[model samples]
Target chain A: MKKVRTKQVIPLFMAGFAVVFGWVGVFKLGFWNPDQGPAPGFFPSIMAVVMFLTSILAFIQSFKEDGTVKYEKQELLVIASGAGIILSTFIIGLVGSCFLYIILWLKVFEKASWKDTLIILAVVAFIVIGVFGLWLGIQFPLGLMEYIL
Target chain B: MQNLQLLLHGFQTALTFQNVGAALIGAVLGLIVGAMPGIGSLAGVALLLPLTYKFNPTTAIIMLGALYYSNMYGGSFSAILLNIPGDSPAIMTALDGYPMASKKKRPGQALLTADLSSFIGGSIGICILTFTGPALANLGLKFGPSEMTALLLIAMTSISWLVGENPTKGVVITMFGIILASIGMDTLSGVPRYDFGNMYLLGGIPFTPYIIGAVGFSQVIKLIMERDQGKGGAATDMKLTIRGSMITKHDFRRLLPPALRSGFLGTFIGVLPGAGATTGSFMGYAVQKKMKSEEELGTGAIEGIASCEAANNAAAAGAFAPLLALGIPGSGTGAVLLGGLMMWGLNPGPLLFTNEPDFTWGLIASLFLSNILTLAIAVCVIPFLLKILSVPVKYMIPCITVVCVVGSYSSSYSMYGVLIMFLSGIAGYLLDKNDYPTAPMLLSFVLAPLLESNMRKAFIISGGSLDIFFTRPITCVLMVVFFGVVATPVVKSMMKNKTAGKASK
Candidate 1:
């Protein structure tokens, strides 16, 4: 119950932060010139205002709310790990990143055997290479492999 | 007689070797994609759309149309066997389907029932499209920006029921989507808004990448997180045995009423913007629940499958209604279809009916053939497809992941698209974690630009008076209907509560 309240309230606070940043991005930064009828920052400025008002309403509502749900740490681990994997993929490229994420998550995090992880990794990598790269002619970023090859 | 001539011409168009080959390929691929969890018909069609850039407009549309209808049938396979609905519309089916699978009383009976109902509903829907699409297109010719704006408003309001416990949150999300939609350069003024000096922002976010990120990548993350919880899919052990006689006499008798009812329901709902298969299937399921005598429902009833299957296929056909008449999509899949239509250099509206009668009628006729073909293919292959269930999830997830990535990259040959894919994926994950429905958010984003542009254009044209929205008779009538539709659920809930109070008294 307490967790749900916190979850609801935090987004509103974050949205408030969004408003401040968005406002600064537009008005404080001097991005809009006097001659500009509707500057590139104009719409975002409006959005920031709306976000700020909505966030305030959200904050008010959070206090009035009753607790109905619980948040779990496992869920957060999933979210963070998934995000981490995706970011790492961008840096190391598809194959290497996917391999690292799969091997570590399965073997270490999931407590699966090394042999099982290796088999899973090999199958995924080969098929992805075969279907996406070869058959479909899609250009997946090779990452560091690009320089090596 | 005129109908006969049109039908003949449609047959001529649909029966060509190229069309047949395209239909066959489309049905096979669509089935495979639809059987995978969370990869809806929309994604499947969108993934295949670029290939059509090389084909003739009619040929390309026919292929996509086939894929669309095939997904309707194929989606049911996963829903019944796995209790994991492959598409949003199949959710209702999973309720009864999972129980039926647990009982193992009938291996393929439920699936066959669903497929047959889809066939029946799809045929009816296609017939409606053939006869009514042209007429509606003719009517749309008279509409201007004001009327279009009113129509879109009606559509958006219908989503009020979908807003969950917090209508405000839904509205906020929707407003956010609309605002995001307005980020790109404006068509009328040639002025950019929120592009942030990036040239990529000029074209606005491409529909395909946003969709894949918001839907596809989000789903993958969700599955991985819930992997051990078996939130992935129900593990059904029984193999489906496909046979013509699997649909018993009782099944046929039980099926027709709900199939026809849901078919009409789906077609009508499909005509409305934002009211696609998800809404249509729910409505059909709700109607079936009401009609059932409490003894027949939630216990592997064939009628349950019939109603949902009927509505889903009908909705698939129904979504084409507004697209053919107004060039506006009623759902996410419809948006992709609209893109395909535009790619063909074919603008759908009243002008289309007169200028390209053959194209319109032929497309309608091809839909009819596609449904029949899907039924034939699914029935013959159901047993084999069900065998795929025995394959370990460990192997399947990676393959599906590859498909998802490929689908995203194939949308455009740009690395930036992949970047957008990951960003949207992250956003989707956050939204999912926060207990927000991604569909409404995605929907609002898609409809935002249309709503804003139309409202702006109408205001400019009307010299800033809101009267333009009311001046048009069709628009006024539509607005009333929209409010009524949005209010019905709330009203029904209130009425139920009142009845309970009276009973207590």
Candidate 2:
């Protein structure tokens, strides 16, 4: 119950940020001019205000919350590392950086055998490049070196 | 008779060598992808979108539609054998399906059960589609923008009922999705909303990346998170056969009624925007539970499998109704198809019927063939597909991740899309940790813009009169249905508690 209530805090804070973000965005960007039916910034600004209000409600509701919610910490590490892998892939090529991250994740964090990890990693990398890159023609950045070559 | 004539013409177009070839290719690929554990029909369709650019508009729509329908049929194979459903629609099947497999001396009996049920259900669904889709398309002929908006509202509100235990949380999540969708430039006006000084945000948050991120990437990431659990092997020593004796007359008697009834329910629910096979299958199973003999449920009953397969397959066909008629897509696959049609320079609406009857009819005709082909392929090749499931999860997760990354990037060749995929993965991880349902969030994200735009459009056209929703007959009917959907669950729960109290007293 406490965890469930606490979870409301995140969405509420995000919602508050949305409100501030919207207000600033609309003011900075301005609404549609004549010959335009609605401004691009118009909906975002409106959403920001709505999100902010809802977040406030969520936050208030969190304080008086009475339900049981379990907070599991194990998942947070995966979240951070997984996001890092994706962000890093854009900087490095699909094969190199993604391999480093997967190895680190599977062996170091999850504690699998090096043989098991390396074998799966190599096969997966090959398949990803072969199927998606070669067959489907998805331009997954092999990074600067490949691009320059 | 008139409808039959048009349908016959449709069959002529569909039966040609080129179109028949497309349906065959679509069925084979869709079944393969669907039978795979992690990848789903939605992903399969999305992955194939880039290829559709090469085909003519009608051929592309027909091919993609075939893939979508077959994936739904194919998902049940994994459910019966593995007990882990390939997709959400297959969840109910896994309940009794796996149990039946264990009980029978021949575990392959479970696999055969699923294949036969899929055949029965899919055929019935296609028959319904042939008879009813044109009539519904005709009804759509009368819908104006206001009515369209009302229909969209019904879709949006209906999410609360379909989502998890908390209706309020579902609504909040849906509202947030709407707000997220509203980011970037206003479609009606060129002004940027929450661009935050980035030119890239001008296109708004691309729905595809978010989908890949939230559902696809997150799922892969979680597999990484739980890599140690590893995968179990498919049951060996089970001789699976598709013989007549296995699916005897008694078995057909058990299966046919549920298959037909669920086909209708699935089609009806599927026609409603934002409702898809998941709800259709669940509702079908729930209804079957009530009508079933106490002796046969959750024991690998053929009826149980038929109910789910029929509704889900029908729902796949039914989802096209709103997309074809109102230019509104009810689910992710429908949304992707809508995008494909628009990319092909074909606008989907009532105007479509008048402007391009051949293309429209061709796509409908192709479905009839696709349904027949799915059964043919499954009966022939499902045993072979089962072999792929034995590959280790540790190995599979990395492959799934690669697919996720490539799938996300393929949506747009932008670096930002990859970033969105990553961020959505993390957010998906967090939501999973908190036990918050992702389906509501994903569904809301898909339908949010339609709901908002239609609402704004309706209000504007009515000169800000709220009565527009009540005053228009179609709108009024849709609104009533929306409220009814929201209230039905609550009423049922209350009645259940009252019954329990009476029994205790």
Candidate 3:
């Protein structure tokens, strides 16, 4: 498989953004309203058009430069860790998810000693649950805990 | 006399035990946070803002303001000791400061110079704020919608041009921010524009979560990616001895002039919307370097550290001038503070003085104490802070990520906010990687609503005519400045090309 060029990514992203913003501006929010001084969609629709034009210019400019993505194992692991943390938040709630993430990230990704992992887990849990949860009285989704309690 | 009386009154409010305690805590935490990599004062302030929700406006502002200024002080510590600038503003400090610490073996002198310069610059900046803030606020009161729109336009353009090498990317990112800001119901009309189908869209995307994700979480990801790299070895064998003999009388005399000059220059730059501490510090360093022979600079010259440190601290204070007076944030951190002020149910601008004198004055007064406290705490805690730097990158990454997740969740008490934060983090990372300046986007996001609302107001008043922006004297001047800011670089590039053509011929 051919790797995507880094220089091309931005122009592509910009083009995609323009399409979405333009579609939303015209279809979802009407282009204009005569009764109102300026319609709700006026600014957004203008922005969409500007973005579309600028992105074309950027695309043309990008063709002159050549730079490709260099995928590395460490970078892939970091990306996976970010995704894992986000997915875990919905599954176990913030406090619980943080605990799971810290353990997995330390033991699996970083390959730290189990003792170090456990110490980190304990300290993180204490702060999240004790300081934020109990003291601040901030609420969070208790995915598994909700069913158990 | 009037200013003095107001300042004394401000001190009275700030001197309360609770306020004093909050200031101290804020200073210490700000120092620690600023000393850490991947989280500067802007992220530090944004992450901690939710915790200030319960406090009164005065106490909250005092704490945040103290945190904001002391963060500047803390940034220099890591810059000097480890050549790793904890924040952009401290980058200049690292150039000369690291050399002083490592090669000259005068780390203590370098730290002391930075601390003293910061304190002196900050104190002068506060004095400037006290006298100028109200007068500027009075002037701001005269500005109507037209003037406001023009001013905001100038600010957006200037920031976009000045911040990064790629002006086109900056402008595009800024437009994106404005588009994001226009997501909720239109302020003038009751009609919802970009809700798509969700009920949550009506209330608009919350600022806190987006900021936390963009500034805080994105940094966490970057740090995690680089976790395997060894920490800079500069701080290992550092020994600090704080004595008068460290910086001789001759050194002090030589440093004082540059420090004083840079302090004023930084303060002036800070008052301008979109110009920040980083710009001020760089400009100060450039001017100081230009004055001396090339050999004197980048060689641990005391003047180099003094000028940069003074300017950056003064710029932090100068940033408050526009914020307090015109409700326009002068820097990215100022933008965050503006959001916090709005959250606290206080409208910034001229009316804030009349509406919440105690809050305004208390914040100003706290600045004085925060700087002094920062100096004392930084000097005493040098050993402890150095220890913090030794903590492995892997440990810091996970801890910060958890904090970001929890902080985002706590802000709105909604899963949606967390999702937005995570997505914003990804967006921020991509944007940063692509060299699209995030500060312009953040600034535009903060200012978009104001600009749109005022533009609409001007149109309504002028019966849908665009002439209002050009008719009013102040508005006309602002519009001209806006055009000047946008055109200057284009003209300069054209001239450069022409010069090269001539030389080739």
Candidate 4:
């Protein structure tokens, strides 16, 4: 059996999506309308066919390459932190979640001293809250805190 | 004369107190970001894009435009001082700049050469854009749906050049971008597309946050993964004062010729679809290699530094023409600016020249202002910019991440934008690791909607017949060229095989 490397997975995933697009485009969405114009799915159908063919070509070409991608521990930790911040935003709001995420990453991963970490934290908070919120007037996600208040 | 009057009017608009302040802030921020080793202009613009949301359309664009133009000047600072290039366009600058600095012991002069040539080249590019912009827009006004579709097709094919080593991979990424863009509601019919039953999907992915996440947040991930990669080179102990940076008359004469030549060449290249400043610099350097130089090319030569540095700055200026005239972004940074135009409630096609002359002319005028401001500021702040290089990557990663989060959230005032940002950041990182270029994806995302709209319009005009693409004279020529571009590599490979078979026999 032939083995696909991690690099090949990107194309395969694209191919998988292409199949779904093509399927839905033809049966559910419709490709051509009675107005002799394109329906909602017309463009998607064209893209689906092209993407499917190109992804297969990419898959075939990936066999010429060597080595699977190795994910480092640091990358995973960073991604986890990103996910944590994102999930926490639903509860604590953007400003709060970012405050927690940044503080933890600096203290734990970077091993920064409290002095430096706090300074960085203070600057970051001022920029996010003072500059972005107060200065620009962008309304951020209130999360569960809005209801609680 | 007509363009000149319009340009003077534009300068009047750009010289306003608020606009001038915006331009100044953009210039300083641009230099800071451009001097930083890993962050390119794409990310820099994306990070700061949120700041301009509150400003008026003209003011906002002038800020972004100045930021984008000054970025080219900033890229050369690190390239000359250290061996590392701040951006891809500066890669050629580093070839001669580093040796000129360290080996020739003229670190100050090397930077000054880059600044001077950048100034000259950028002036030429801005001049060309001022005249060409309205003419191009006038020409574009003649393009019907069929002609527009063909022109966009040619533009779309340019993505193949950015695909890196794998053409197939480029196609995959381009298609993926189109698919992503198609996820929102269908504009014509008001029907939802590829939304997966999510409410946010109906609104589509936010462009600014997507850009910030893909370009900025992904860099943060890379910094974390390779903690030791951001090390600064030995840059201390050099007399970096403006007086110490002056070049001799003979050296200036040598630099002037190459800078002038590359200025014209780079501007034309920048106007081409997807070529941008990186290719402009490379081609400029390549041409200079055949010409006579005062010193051997690439080993501390003034000509070598001038050629690429000038070309890149010119190309950055030239990219605005297509963006303003055709509503087509000539580079990734231009795509971000195009997205900004959409967000600002302005249409950016052929009508832009007639409809919004102040906005168009003001942006063009600001480039000239930025060219001067950047040169003076770049020369004065070399000592300050060098300090930014020493700030540890660990510190940079967190600050940049917070900015990315906040910027994403601000784009649409929701968590949905942030979620898309994180997801695309992962996708961007993966693409970067595997040698798949992210630029083509972003460009495709911006172009797909326009292309789809035009093509559908052409079909509507043609009554569902395919001849609409081939029947019109201008469309015929563009389509023919598009086919030729697509077929050349395939034909060349076939010829190579035939020759190989004959040789084996």
Candidate 5:
């Protein structure tokens, strides 16, 4: 079996995404109606078709290219951190999640001192809560704190 | 004379303490953001866009406009002192600016020349815009849906062609953007199209988060990916002093002519859709080089610095002309400004002059004042800017990410917006990694609804006939130009292939 290439992955993914999107637009969204001019799905269906065709062209173009998926350890860490952010956002509130994210990013990724991480986290939390919450009056969603508070 | 009176009234509004302060803060912020690598004026404006939510329309426009033009001045700093350009427009400046600073040992002089030339260019651009804006708006008032559709088509096609490496990719991305835009409740039909059974997406993926994620967060990711590559390091060793006689009499004499010429040239280029500061700077630099000897052209010639800097600044000012007068954005930044205008509930076309003369003229007047403020603030903040460059990228990354989250959330006061931003950032990163240009996607996304609505109106008026586009003189001309822009590259590539085939034979 031939190994998959990074160049091929994107186009293949794009093609798959386009097909699904097109299917949804056609079957679910209702692509056309005789009484009305163009329906809402008309534009999207056209886009889906165009995207599908382009993805195929892109795939064909990628076949001649010589490259492979090359993910380093650092890249994996970055991806993990990105996931950590989303998970934390759901687990904690916006401000709390941001606080946790800063601490972890600083301590783990940046390898900063505990003292510095704590200090920076305090400042970031103050600014985020102060400016956005107090000043702008934005009502951020509460997560775990919702029950406690 | 009446224009002059209106400008004075504009000055009265702009010179208020609050407005002046906003402009000052905007200029300072723009300068810092522009000097930072991986963040250009687009992201700078996008990052700060949420802050404008509380301000009045005039103040918001004033601050955003100040940020946009002052960014041009800031971009030249890194281009000169270091070989790295702070923004795309600054790329040409780096060609000669770095050479001048390093070889001539007059970094201050190089910076001063850039600043002065930028001022000259900006002043010229504002003067032209002030006079031509109303006149152009009058002409634009004559435009119907057919003409508007034609103009929008031209704007979309031009941006798609000029912005990216591959025009095909640009068009595809633009189409995707239009699809994304069509996801919300269709205003005419009163039907939600592609919300995917999700309540959060009902408003159609709030634009602020989408843009912030795409431009800002993706930039952070790109920076992280390149962190080990030793990019974004400080130029601490290079001393950028401002105390001495920066621009000597001799240097001024040599720089004046090219600066003035490029100022006009840049302004003209800026007025054209999709012809931005990058094009203006390169064209101005090329023209100056063609006029001079080889010795004077590339190797730290003051003329080289003057032409590029002046042209880019002028182009920055010139870009506002179309946006203000015709509601057609001339560049990516201008498109963002157009979005801001819509957000403020102010229509940006001809009626804007009559309906809100204060906002229109105040913005124009503020441009002139901002140039002067930029010069004063940029020179004073050189030391501070140099120090900022020394701050480690690691510390900045988390902070910027936090800002992106807060900024996106602040726009609509929703966590879903922040999530949208994160998702958009991932999508942006994936697309960007594949060599797709996001600016065209962004421009098209902003224009998509406007284009669709106008096209619909045009067809309805014409009783569902496409021939309406050809029947109108302005629309006919615009359609021809649109096709010409699209066809030129294809024809050129075909000719190149033919020549290559003959060579092979």
Candidate 6:
């Protein structure tokens, strides 16, 4: 079997999405209604068709391209940090996740001095707490700590 | 002229303590964010948007407007000093700006030319927008459902132009945006759409968070990937003061002509659908290449810096015309601003001029104020800005990430928005990695609902007949133009292929 190129991945993914969307649009959501001029499904159904055709075209076109950009090793840390931030929010909440992610990323990965890390941490804290919290008054999501408390 | 009086009144409103204060803050923040590499106007606006939720619609918009306007000035700083453009529009500025700064040994003068050129270009754009905005709104009022549908179709087609080379990828992304937009509910029938039965899908994806994730957070992922990639070393050794950055009379004379020409040209480009400052600056630089310059462009010429710098600022000002007049966004930042307008509880579109003259005009007046404010601040802070460029990418990565997290969460005060931000950030990185343009997706996402609404309304009016799009005069003209835009590429490609085929044979 021939190995698939990284470039073809997204187009193929979109093509598959279009197929499911087209099926749902036609069957579940009617394309046209008797009373309404165009049904809810009308635009989506048409768009799905266009999307599928274009995605397939893009997929085919990808074969002509030479080199593909590979993922960097450091990028895994960033992705992990993003996931960790989101996951941390479940336990520590929004503000805590900010503190945790910044600290770990700076200390563990960046290997920055504690003094530099704390200074950046303080500025970020001011923004999240002093500005976003006290000033703007946005109600942040409650973590498990809040629920437990 | 009535515009003069309205503008004067606008200044009166803008001169108020709060509005002036807002403009000042916006100018400062705009420059800071604009100077930062990787965080362009789109992300700047998106990251700052959540902070404005508590502001009055007028004040919030004034700040964001200043931020957007001044950002054009901020972009040239790094482009000239370092080789990296702070934003996409500044790519052209870098060509001559860095050369003039380094090779010519006039970093101060290069920075000055950019600031002055920005001032002149932005002023030209504002003046044109002043006369044209109300006039366009008046014209837009004459448009009914069919005409609006046609106009929106034109807007939708312009996004295809943004995707250079691969028409198929453009089409795929554009359709994908429209589909994503259709997920929440049908506006006409009040029926639920492709929500997949998720409770959060009932409200659809939140606009601000989606934008922040797509443009800003994605940069986080991108920066992480490229952390080791060298940033042409920061100019840390030099210290610059405003007085030190003065240009010679000869330099100013050389700068003025191209700046003036590009100002008008950029303004015209700005008003076009899906054409923003990037195109404006690119075009301005390209035009200067043909004309006589004091020195050849890309070789430390003042004219080269002036042309692109002036044009981008002019284009930034000009973009407000369509957004304020017809409620159409020409580019991603324009779309973000449109989203801001809606968030501030003001209706955008033709009626916006008639109904909310104060809000509309105040924003325009504030641009003039911001241009001056940004110029002064931009000059005084050149020394400080270099220091910012020196900030390690390692620190910036975590800082931007936190902002993305906080900004997304603040939009709706929910983890749902944050989830969308993360998911979209990953998707955005993937799309960007594959060389797919995200600007079209963002543009269509904002315009698709308006397009679908107007299109459906036209269908309803026409009793399901397609003739409505073709029958009305204004609509017919617009549809003709839309078809022309859509068909031109296809025709060109066919011609190219035919020529190739003949040669091959």
- TM agreement with the true structure for every prediction: 0.71, 0.71, 0.72, 0.71, 0.70, 0.72
> What is the descending DockQ order?
6, 4, 3, 5, 2, 1
Instruction: Give me the displacement of residue B475 in model 4, in angstroms.
Output: 1.9
Docking class of 6: medium
Error of 3 at B258 (Å): 11
Clashes of 3: 0
Q: Which DockQ-derived CAPRI band holds candidate 5?
A: acceptable
Candidate 4: docking tier: medium
Give one digit per residue, the lDDT tens place, for model 3 in B370-476.
99999899777755544534557777678767766776677667877777777888787767766666656665676678677887788878877889988899899
- Candidate 6's displacement at residue B251, Å, is 12
Which of the two candidates, 2 or 6, achieves a greater DockQ against the reference?
Answer: 6
Residue A32 local lDDT, model 3 = 57
Which residues of candidate 6, in runs, are more than 4 Å off?
A1-5, A63-69, B1-136, B229-367, B378-386, B497-505
lDDT of each: 0.67, 0.67, 0.75, 0.80, 0.75, 0.80
The true-versus-predicted C-alpha distance at residue A49 of model 5, in Å, is 2.0
Worst 10 residues of 6 chain B by lDDT: B229-238
Q: What tens digits encode model 5's per-residue C-alpha lDDT throughout B73-103? A: 9888867764445676776677677667656
**Alpha-carbon RMSD of each model:** 6.6, 6.8, 6.9, 7.6, 7.6, 7.1
lDDT per residue (tens digit) for residues A22-122 in model 3? 78878766765565566667677787777677766766776765565444455445556667766776667667778888888888778999998998787
- Candidate 1: tens digits of C-alpha lDDT, residues B96-156: 6655654544537777888888988888887787777756434434556777677667656
- Pairs with steric clashes in candidate 1: none
Off by over 4 Å in 2: A1-8, A21-77, A99-126, B2-20, B31-65, B68-125, B132-134, B162-168, B219-226, B232-262, B265-365, B378-389, B486-505
Model 3, runs deviating above 4 Å: A26-35, A134-137, B1-122, B132-134, B162-168, B220-225, B232-367, B378-383, B431-439
DockQ of 5: 0.39
